[model samples]
Target: MSKQPPLDKFERDVLDESVPIQQLLRLVIVLGGRAFSEPLRLWARNELQGYPGPGIPLPTYRMITAPLQMDSHSRFSQGRNETISALALPDVAHDLVSEQLPVTFSVGKLQNLISHQDPHTPLKLGLPGSAELARLMTSERSGQGVVVERIYWSVHASALHDILEQVRNRLLEFVAELRATMEPGESEPTVGQVHQAAQTINITVGDHSPVHVIAPHRHSATVSFPTRPHHRWWPRR
Candidate 1:
């Protein structure tokens, strides 16, 4: 029988619920660098650093649906924050107020947010173009002096937690598949082999479209992971 290899150890580490997401992510980064796959490295980097800008499309998993809220006050009242419907806003603001808002915070940042926030409180995200939308709303009112102060998307902490879970699950699926590709007794995989494994699972690894819509993996395994403990691992050169 073939002896356990480095890939096997890495696989075990991935399956260990105790391993922090950041550490696993760093390992992925190392693997990507070793494989010389820019796409692989880019995926890991984006997760660690958050998506850079609009130019880089976010993975479908990062998109979330949440309640749109508006904080406003009239000349009479102090301020009121309440859930606002998209229809209430001008047509110009409709697109920004939709259910799906891309979350671009890094893994560490997300964990920090969850730790600091109360479980019941929803995380508020200020939407772009909110000021302009507020102006439009005030103009529509045209008399009562109801000025909108903020327009934001309110997401539950659990929702953010779910994003981390999805990422972890996807990583588990990836490493398991990659390990399976190694020949018995092979301690390491070739660059071609690594690239092939990524392609088989439809992970973004190279020059393809930046956005990836995750699908059910053909090699999906039924496993439950423990709640991850907070730990951090910074990548090394």
Candidate 2:
């Protein structure tokens, strides 16, 4: 039987970070760069530098990595590694911090929120940066800005639901690509090669940078991450 992957610290961080990203992607990261009002862009233009967080409305991100071989016998198997990431939309906070968004919370919150749902709700969402952030409760979005009411969200939780759906589809690409070929920083499993394989892998969400999104009227709390530190052995280069 194939050995099960271990639950590591990064696993928790990645899941945590993916939550807000899922939200930002759904709400702020819209269909196009032109989604933002031109006036807003102009206002924020000179003052608005490029960033990874929320600010611009719609943008794109990239996760770049050049995994070095881990096998002691592989060519580029020396102790060198590289990683790259890109962000879509951006925010002020993300601009100040660039790509350093929290990873542990985004993924965790997203998974918890998506797994369960009520059949009659408006996809309840807890407000960010408040006592609610602590509660982490699943509530519905009722009423509006000034008089918003918190209802339990369940049945109508289809909004953020698609992000994970996208994630799954994207994950298929990973599975598909790796299914037939040897992965970087990876060694082909061989009965006589070695009795042991790497026991630890590192996943840096967005690498040293965090993905951000931008909006005109509302401030966007954004998040984006890339699976990092995927380690294996290649050669002794």
**Candidate 2 lDDT, tens digit per residue, 76-166?**
2322111112121112112322222222123334456566756353343221232331122112211211211221112233444543444
Using lDDT as the measure, the top candidate is 1
Per-residue accuracy of model 1 over 1-237 as CA lDDT, tens digit each: 976555666678777877778887887777766666567677878888888766676777788898788888887885645888888878765654586777888988999899999999888887766666677777877787787887788989999999788778878777766668766765666665666566543544223454332223322221212111212222111
Candidate 1's displacement at residue 83, Å, is 1.5
Question: Candidate 1: where is the Cα deviation over 4 Å?
Answer: 1-5, 75-79, 204-237
lDDT of each: 0.70, 0.27
Candidate 2 ranges with C-alpha deviation above 4 Å = 1-52, 55-105, 124-155, 183-237
- The local lDDT score (0 to 100) that residue 121 gets in candidate 2 is 39
